[model samples]
Target: MNAPVFRRVLALLGDLRLAILLLLVIAIASIAGTVIEQGQSLSFYQTNYPEDPALFGFLSWRVLLALGLDHVYRTPWYLTLLVLFGASLIACTFSRQVPALTTAQRWQYYQEPRQFTKLALSTTIPQGSLKELATALSAKGYRVWQTDNQLYARKGMVGRIGPIVVHASMILILLGGILGALTGFMAQELIPSGETFHLQHIIQAGPLARIPQHWSVKVNRFWIDYTDAGDIDQFYSDLSVLDAEGQEVKRGTIHVNQPLKYGGVTLYQADWSIAAIRFRLNNSPVLQLPMAQLDTEGKGRLWGTWLPTKPDLSEGISLIARDLQGTVLIYSPKGEFLTSLRTGMSTEINGVTLTLVELVGSTGLQIKADPGIPLFYAGFALLMAGVIMSYVSHSQVWGLQEKDLLYVGGRTNRAQLAFEQELVAIARELASQSQTAEVQA
Candidate 1:
């Protein structure tokens, strides 16, 4: 590219108007994402957002899917916006903040007394000497630098670098977000106790995501705790991570908020359900019956299983349960009430002894893996530190002495009221000390 074109590109990138416009677009897109759900199935949107009464008179599920609004952060256009925003921040930092900081660091002396009069806070002292003014400035915690009849001092120089640090931290955070959106995955599974499974059934995955195939998990146990009101207090699942050779590498009991983490993946105990029941008849070996959930048409949730009483499988009874409270209602094939039994109990029905065995429960787990969480956290820390540093108030003072007159002036970037008060106090002190010395003489 030509030099002028390069400079024009730099100027455009560093323009505050361009940065504000990008920020506005990002904000609008984020609001749209929050309002419209992301990472949902096509069927879900078709059912929720029908075409008959399209939202806003033309925005239907087909439109949403076509625009890739289902996964905004993963879409190419959204990612392009992030990249452009990051570039603007970089250009602004280099072209404006760095140069401003360099200028703030270099000292400029007021060779003529008229220059001191241009300051926001300036005064002429007829009695105080340059040395006395420097001493007073030093006593007030300024880093004094002197040359012949001119003196310069400043404090809180770190404040000049705070905006740069803030910009850097913001860039790091954006990088972390982009990385996570490009290489992370989410999955959910429901595994019965004593069953081993791998990380399959992915709900959402990024294009660059690499799913772990060598790792497996086992559900050792699952149980629930009851509250004093006979309601569910909490549910727990004992989980183990297994290697390729089926050896346990990690084990832990996970609950709702307490999750198990292993090899950069997190497993959360999300839900639970009764899978099957183990029981046996007289002179018969142990048998496991699979349980099926009945459709109550949104009235209530119930699980049922049919137990065979006769060898011909003609005569059977239905076992119905509502919750993990260990109570089950037994009914005949004709929906006639037979008996109610608890776990580890026996009841004779249709001339056969049926024993109620343990109810097998399965644990529902949600798994996630993201590689950029640490970088995001570190960027947040740096941002907070920079924000605090930005409030420190860079202050500077200059002094000049000629004949019997001394010129003094100072200024600060922030805390203007407090700086003015301090400057007034120092001038008063200088005048009072000069009067004391004259009296002693």
Candidate 2:
């Protein structure tokens, strides 16, 4: 590109209005991502946002798919916006904020006494020496620099650096977001107790995501805690991380809100379900049957299994469990309620002894791996520090001793009232010292 065109492009990208617009668009896209279910099948959107009436008169499954709203964060356009915003911050920092800070750091000595008259706070004091003025300004926390007749003092140079730091921190945050979008992966698993598994059911994954193949996770046990009112209080899973040799490397008990982290992978206990039931029937070998959750039509979770009481399968009883608390409700072949049995309990039905062994529970875990977490933490910390530093006032004071008259003036970028008060106090101290010197003479 030509020099003029390149400069124009940079200016357009660094415009404050453009930055605000990009931020607003990103915020709206985030809200849509949160409101719409992400990483779902096409049938989900078809059923939820049907074509008949359409949502808000214009939004339907077709629009959602066309706009890539189903997965907003991973979409090409959203990622492009992030890249553009980061570029804007970089351009603005180098072209604007950095230069402003450089200018603030450079000292400007007032050559003419009339320069004091143009300042916001200026005063003329007779019989005041440059040495006395420097001493007074230094006493008020100003870094004083004096020559034969000129003096310049400043404080709070950090205020000038704060904007540059803020811009850099924002760029870091944008980079972290883009890195996460390109390299993160999320998966879910439903593993039965005592079973080991790998991350296979990938719900979402970035194109560059590196899925770990050298490790596997095993669920040693899964259980639930109940409150005094029989409500579910909490659920827990004893998990172990295994290496390639099937040796345990790490173990921990994970529950809701508390997760296990290993090798950049995190496992959270999301849900639980009934896996299988073991029992004995009529002196036969121990038989284990898989239990399936029934569709309760929003009533609650119910799992059931059928056990044959006769050798010909002509008669059987249905075993149903509502929770892992081990209360199994048995029903007759005619759908009549028979009796309830707990774990290790036995009851006779159809002249055959039915023994209830144990109910195997499965743990549902959500696994996630993101490579940008460290960058995110560092960016947030810098952002806070920059904000605090920005609040400090960068004040500058100038003084010139011309013969019998001393010209004093000051200015500040912020906290104007406080800066004015401080300058007045310094002037009063100089005047008092001059009077004390006259009396001693």
Candidate 3:
């Protein structure tokens, strides 16, 4: 109702404690999803957990639908956590750290006369008598400013700014990541060989939105290479370029590391599949085999009938199908006979000549487009920079001038002990310089 109440509500929502708690919960839930397997059908979960009532109940379709655990990052609650984390970082920047930075940046040298006079490292030098001390301080890279009544000095100011740069980078990165998660879309499609298709709606966006109406892509060819040991070493695809108007322009290939780009959209080589297979009866005429290829429609093209050039049927035959699902087809050369078969399944025909045995299939093409990718990447770089600056830096200084003294101190978000050591060193340097200046003056 009031601004104060609203601010307080926002502050509580953006608290680091709440963020940490949400992060932990999200992490645990993510691990559970991975362990239990996500996207599994209700029947699968039920089958796996048939004997465990608790697991069955927890993994029930109703529970998953209610909690949105099936799609964690996209789920409303998970997205809410991300929003909260971003708000917390923003609040921390404005509320707790900005003032601290201002004080540290504008830090000035100050101390009481009595405090300096009672110090173990104080010295009383004649006026205009500390030129050599100034030279030594200058050599150590301190910016020295002085009047007859007082002195002002600053050192490592640029170095001090490093932390700020790093922090700003982190905030930039966080904001970028949040923006991307909110606005970006990444989708994949598998086009079997001989099939023609265009980019459709993205199924993977955290929130479903119309895919960029301006974007679309098509896969022309896909290939894979394997080591002698049967390990995959590389994968790639040749793609036909298409505009939203369905016009063909450029055609090129892309590998796992290299992606094809067109009109601000990038198509990645995601996967492959068996497009089709060809089989002709043995003892059949060469003419009977006919032309077996994929047509523009992506369907298997076969021209000719089961009747063979040979008048007599000879021996039984084999048809081997390949791909994830190996469905085979067997037929006789001379007669009207055809039968269906699957991988690892075979039959003995009395007189069937399955001569030209062939295997075929299409490569599944995967497409993706996300305008926020660059922003997300830039944000990643900035966030890391901020974290390093916040944690690894140390800032401090001390001064002794006749009857007056000053101590200035500040530190990075990390390594307080190292910061204290640095503070002690600066103090020692000033104290030692004072003692030497008094002796010479």
Candidate 4:
């Protein structure tokens, strides 16, 4: 590139206004992503955003799909914005923050007494010795440098480096977000107790996702705790991670808000359902029947099973259960209420004694694997440290002695009033200690 063109490019990258505008755009995009719901199926959008009367009078499912709003973070445009913002941060940090910090670190000596008068806070003490002044400034935490009759000091130079740290942390956070959007995945699975499964029902996955194939999970057991009033208090699932050889590598009992983690995958207990039942007929082997949920049309959730009691399949009984409270309602095939039985109880229908053994429950689990969470946490730590460092004021002081006339001046980039008060205190202390000291500006 030509010299002028390169300079223009650098100018644009370092432009504060451009950086702010990009940040605003990213914020707006993030808000939209949060509100619109990402990674949903096409049917979902079509159902929610019908065509007849579109959202906002013009925006519909078609528009949403056309603009890639279904997955904003993974879309090329949003990723491009992140890349551009990161470039801006790099350019600004290198071209502005670093150089400014370097300039702040290099000390400059005031060679002339007249230079002291230009400071916002300047004074002259007639009887104060240079040794006393230097010692006083050093005691106040200033990094002092002295030469025969001239001295220079500064403090809080870390303030100059704080902006660079803040920018670097923001860049790290943005990179983490981008990495997560490109390499993470989420899925859901429901497995009955004693059944094994793997990551199969993926709801959302990034392009570079590494789907787990060599590992499987088994639901060892699932149970629920009920309160006194017969309401559910909590549910737990004992899960075990199995390797390719079916060897258990990890195990944990996970509940709501408590998740199990293994090999970077986290499994959360999200839901539960009645899966099946174990029962026995008179003088026969135990049999298990898979239970199916019944549709109540928004009334309540119920599970049911039908058992045939006759040889020719002519007569049968129906069983319905609402919860694991251990009570089941039995009804005749002709829609007559028969009787209610609890777990470990038996009933006779058509000369066949049916014993209710146990109800098999399944655990609903949500699985997620995010590789960038550590980076995000580290970035926030740096950002907080940088914010505190930025609060310190970069203060500077200069002193000179020209033929017994002591010239002193000090200033700071921040906390100007406090710096002025500090100067007053130093002047007062010097005056109190020296009998011949006279203070003047």
Candidate topping TM-score: 2
In Å, residue 415's CA in model 4 sits off its true spot by 1.9
User: Evaluated with lDDT, which candidate comes out highest?
Assistant: 2
lDDT of 3 by residue, 1-441 (tens): 899997897678657787688668767866766776555556865666554464646565566656766656556666666666666666756665665667656744444455444433333433323344445446656666654434545564444445556546655655555555565566667665444566673555644334555534555655566677745577667777766677777777887767777665677766654544444444333331222332436553332223232456344333323232344554554444467665434343555444333334445444555555676677667666655555544333334345343333333344556555654565466567667866896
- The C-alpha TM-scores of every prediction are 0.95, 0.97, 0.68, 0.93
TM-score of predicted model 1?
A: 0.95
Better of 1 and 4 by TM-score: 1
As for candidate 1, its clashing pairs are none
Ordering by TM-score:
2, 1, 4, 3
Superposition error at 202 for model 3 (Å): 4.7
lDDT of 1 by residue, 299-356 (tens): 9778899998898998899999877778889998899998998888888888887787
Give candidate 2 misplaced runs (Cα > 4 Å): none
Model 2, 1-441: lDDT tens digits are 999999998899889999999999999999999999999999999999999899999899999999999989889999999999899888888879988988988988999988888999999888888898888777778898889999999999999899888888888888888888899999999999999999999988888999998999999999999998889999999999999999999999999999999999999999999999989886777789999999999999999999888879999999999999989999998899999999988899999998888999999999999888888998999999999999999999999988888899999999999998988988888888778888998
C-alpha positional error of residue 133 in candidate 2 after TM-score superposition, expressed in Å: 2.4
- Residue 22 alpha-carbon offset, candidate 3, angstroms: 3.4
- List lDDT for all candidates, in order: 0.88, 0.92, 0.54, 0.89
Q: Model 4's lDDT to the true fold?
A: 0.89
